[model samples]
Target: MLIQPVADLLSRNADHYLIPADIVANVQTDNNLYHAFLVLTKIKYSKIPVLDHAGHFEGLISLPLITEQMLGFDQLNVEVLMEKRVSDVMETQVKTVPNVDDVESTLHLMIDNPFVPVVDNDGLFQGIVTRREYMKSFNFLTHEIGKQYDMIEKDFSTSEKSK
Candidate 1:
């Protein structure tokens, strides 16, 4: 695992879910639940990025936020009804693990966040690590180990049978 590439660890698993960096659905602070829902339905993610007038990460609009507001409103407007940007709702206090970290360390850090952003030494987002991915890799490793033991057992049994 020490010498293994992140790509190898990633490749052992078949499922890879990713969100595009730029295609985030967003709404102005003034938008309402109607607008939010419209955008959400179009985007692949329930978690939407919120941008300010200047086009920066302002907060995030989530299902919960829409639900909360829609519960009370018959009609909604963009300015009054729109939720904050992702910066507001996103886990701004991000916990990161280095790409070079061993699987064990990565597992430990993953205990908190389902997805941990992988970063290089310069702090650029290389990729993300998910508990599901780790579990898949672990499962593959265990399965391989089990197969080895089973082969050994079968070989011993064959030898004994001959004796």
Candidate 2:
């Protein structure tokens, strides 16, 4: 099949690529680092979404960043460090794509961000599309494409043998 058909299928399904907020844990700005760390460790998520008390998307936080903060202080200061708010450590330079944006574009953004936060036209927090989930979808497509290629090869061999 032509590449256009594949592109069309992927672009057309863009609306459904987002992983709804209900399924993921979003951290609050006022949440303590200790709590945030616990959540990240428990979920094993690649990235965590940071939101305000009103549910607005702020930025994305990773375990490594938080770990770095913890390492900045000595063991005696660990307690004080954990008491710091997530907003203090989370990356404020987060890149967000509008919810209306196509999945193809979102996939590109996911190349750098493990979790791409989805926002509404007004920039309210909607959900995220995780790299892990995206990879799963891409992997499935790769398997299907391999199967198609094998079928075509088998067909070509049979036709040549008959000729």
Top model number, lDDT: 2
Cα lDDT, all candidates: 0.53, 0.74
Candidate 1 residue lDDT tens string, 11-110: 5453443323343346654555567667877775564555456554434566666655445357544553455433333334455555534455666777
Candidate 1 lDDT at 147 equals 50
| TM-score on alpha carbons, each prediction | 0.47, 0.74
lDDT of 2 by residue, 2-29 (tens): 2654455454445666888778787888
C-alpha root-mean-square deviation, candidate 1:
8.2
Q: What's model 2's lDDT at 34?
A: 81
Q: Which regions of candidate 2 deviate over 4 angstroms?
A: 1-3, 72-76, 136-163
lDDT of 1: 0.53
The CA lDDT at 39 in model 1 is 80
Q: What is the lDDT of residue 154 in candidate 2?
A: 44
